[model samples]
Target: MVECGAKHLIYVSRSAGKSKDDENFLHELQVHGCRTQTFAEDVADSSLIKKVVQNAAKPIAGVIQMSMILKVQGTWNLHNAIPGKDLDFFVLFSSLSGILGQIGQVNYAAANTFLKAFVQYRYSLGLPASVLDISAMADIGYVSNRPSVLAQLRCAGMQMLKEPDVLDALRLAILRSLPTPSAAYETTSTMATGFHSVSNPAHLATAVATDTSILDDEETSGELLAIQIGKQLLTFMLSTESEEELDLGRAPSDMGVDFLVSIEIRNSWRQSFRSEITVLGILNAHSLKDLGKMAAKNLKEKFERRNEAMK
Candidate 1:
C-alpha cells in the first residue's frame, strides 16, 4: 500500500506494541508524508472493529484482515462489521491447511476454510474480497520456526516462499481477486499431492500395491513394513543417530513430532498402505508402534475383503 502511494495508514492489531520491523516500516511511511495511526484492537470483536473503522479521519479504502482465532464466531462478527461499501478490497490471510488437512490444527484449518467460503460469499453480494491460502513461509512464522515441521513439509513436497516473495504475492492478490480462493496467489504451490521416496520409487510402488492374500507370510511381511514406516517417521521427526536405536514404542508427540509431522506420517501411510484411514484415527495414534499396527491391520483387512469377494 505504501508503494501504491496510500496517503494514510490505519494499522490494527490485538497487541499494544509494534514489532521493530513494523515500527521501521511505519517510520518510512511517515517520512514519505503518509499519515499513519496504529490501533490496539481485536478485529474479531465487531463492536471494537466497527468503532475504530468509523472513527478514521480518512475514508477507509482497503482492509486486510489477518486476525486468526480458532472459533467461527470471531470471523462471523468481523464479517458483519466490515464496511463492504466503503472498501476497495478486503484481503484475508488464510493458510494452505484449509485446502489440505493439518494435524492438531482442525480448528485453525476450519476457521481459515471459512474465510475462503466467506470470500465467495462476499463476491456473491458484489463485494471485493480475496482469501490468500499461503504456502509455508520460510525463515519466519509458525511453520519455519520448528525444524521438524519444516522437514516434514519438504518431505511432503510443500514449497517454501521467501518473505519478499510472500509480500509480492499478497500485493498481487489484493490487486486482482481470482475466481477460486486457492488461486489467490498463482505463485504459491498447493500442498503436496502424494508421497514419493527419492531413493526408491520401487519401495513405495510395491509396498503400496502389495497383495496380502498371495503372500504366504502375510503377518511377517506386514510387521516388517510397519516397522520400516515407524523408523522412517522417527528419522524425520527426531535427532536420531541410528534408525535402529529409536524406540518404536515412543508416542509421536514424545518424539518431538508436531501437527505437520503427524500429517506427513499419515500421508505416508495413505500412499504406502493404500488404506483409507480417517484423519481423526491418524491424529489419535498414541505411538508410532500403534500407528504401524493399525496400518498393517488395515492393509490386511483390505486385501482379505478383496479375496473374499473374488472367492
Candidate 2:
C-alpha cells in the first residue's frame, strides 16, 4: 500500500522475528523505488517504545501499531506522542480475545479491555487523531504447545467434576441463568453489531425496546465516519469464526497461527478507549478431565440411541 504514494505509516508488532521479516519487507519496498523508515520494538519495553517514537521522522501523518500482550495504556502512550500537526490518523490493531476473554488467556483479556477503554478516552480528548480497533481472526501461531504436569493435574480434576452428570448440571444451571433482555438507543457508528454494553447492563437489557434517534443537528465528519465504519466492517468480517477454530494451544512459530489484526481508538480526555487484556495461560488438569468425561458421556448417549434404534 505504501508504494502507491502512501507517504506516512507506522507498523508495530511484538514478534521477535520481525527483524528478519522486516529486511525482506524493506527490500521489496526498495525495489519499488519507495523510501521508508521502519522501527522494530517491543510494546512491553517502555524505553524501547519511547526511543522508537522519538526517532520517527518529522511531519508524521499516520501511526499504526499492534497491541498484543502489552497493556492498552502502553499503546495509548505511543499514540499520544504523535504530534497533532503531523498526525492525521492513528490505527490500532486489537484482538477478539481482548473483547471476549479466552479460556486460558486472562492476562490477554485484561490488556485488551484496557485498550477498549483507552479508545473512548481518546474520543473524549477531541484529538484530531481517530482510533480504529480492527478485530481480526486469531493468529494460530501464538498458541502454546507445551503440556506440563500442571495441565495433567487440572485435567484430572475435571474428571472428578464431571462424575455423575455434575458438570452437565452446572452447565445447564448457568445457561438457565442467562437473561434475555433488549433495549434500543443511538449507538456509536464504530460499535459492532454484537458489541454489548457490559458496562451498562440495565441499558443493554432494554436496548431492543428503545428506538435510536439519529441526531441530524450533530454531524460527524466524513473522515471520522469513514474510519468508524471501516473498523466496524473489518471487525465483523474478521471475527466470523469460532475461537476454537484458531487452536490457541499452538505457538506463534506454528504454520497454522499466522497473524491477527484489530483496531482501537484512544481519547484520554474521556477515559474511554479500547483495551485488550489477557490472562496467563493456565491448564488445569481437572478441567480437562471434566471435559473429557463430558465428551465420553455424550458419546455414550449417542451409542445408546443407536442401539435402541437397532432393537
Candidate 3:
C-alpha cells in the first residue's frame, strides 16, 4: 500500500512481533521509508482498540477486515474507531460457503453473511465498500494446509480458485475501470458476489432444466472461450501475477512452453475444455491465439458430433 500513497501503516495483531523475521520485516519497510505501528492486541478487545485511535503515529486509515467469527466485532471496532472518515476502500474477505450455504458451518457462514450485510450498511452511509466471496485456493491459506478439505472440495467437483484470481477480484474491487470477470454475478461498485465453482455441472444442468439460470453469451462464444483457454495456458507457463489480457499473438514456445508443459497443457485442456489439443500442436502452434482457436474448433466439432448422435 506504500506504493498507493499509504506511507504510515498499522497492525492489529494478537501477538507483537519480537522475532528475527519481525526485525527483517520492519527493516524492509524502513528501506522503503514507511512508518508503522503495531497495536499488539486482539481487535475483539474494544478497550485495546480504543488505544489504537488515541495513539496515532502519523494519522490512520480505513477498513480491510479478514477474521473468522470476530469479523462482525472486528469490523464494528474499526467502524466505531473511524467514524465520518473518507476511506479509499473498505475490503472484506468473505467465503463462498456463506453464499452457497455449506453444511456443518453454521457459525462460519453466519460470520461471512454479516460481511455481506456490513458492505450494504457502508453503502447506506455513502462509504466505499467491497466484499469478495472467495473460493478454495490450491496454494496458500486454510485449504493448502489441509489435504482432506482439498480432497472433499475436489470430490464435490468444485474448481479451486487461485491466488492470482483473488488478486484480480481485489483489483476489480479497488479499481472499477477493469472489466469484471465474465463469471461475476450481482456485481456493483460496492460488491462482486458469486462463486461459479460451487455451482457444479449437475447443479447447472438442474438450473437449465428449471430455466432459472442460463449460460450467457460469453460462455457460448468460441472466441471468448479461446481467450479463456489462452489465459489458462499463460497461467501454467508464468507466475501467478501476470496480465490476463496478455498479447495472444506471441508464440507459446517463446513463452516457455517446453515438451513436458506442452503435454500437461494438452491433457488438462482435454479434460476441462474437452479439446483435442495435442502436445505437438501446442509446441508447433504459430501463436497462443492460434492454439486457442485450434482448441476451440476441436471442441466445436466434438459438441457437434455429440449433438448429431443425440438427435
**Whole-model Cα lDDT per candidate?**
0.63, 0.38, 0.64
Residue 128 error, candidate 3, Å: 1.6
Residue 33 displacement (Å), model 3? 3.4
Please, what are the lDDT tens digits per residue for candidate 1 over residues 14-76? 763467888887788889989888888876667887887677879888777766662356556
What are the root-mean-square deviations of the candidates from the true structure over C-alphas?
17.3, 21.1, 10.9
Count backbone overlaps in model 3: 0
**TM of each candidate vs. truth:** 0.53, 0.42, 0.59
Error of 1 at 73 (Å): 4.0
How far residue 188's Cα lies from its native spot in candidate 2, in Å, is 3.3
**How much lDDT does candidate 3 score?**
0.64
Q: Give the TM-score of candidate 2.
A: 0.42
Better of 1 and 2 by TM-score: 1
Candidate 3, position 64, lDDT: 66
Residue-level error in angstroms, candidate 2, position 13: 5.0
Best by TM-score: 3
The segments of candidate 3 whose C-alpha lies over 4 angstroms from its true place after superposition are: 3-5, 16-23, 176-187, 190-229, 232-311
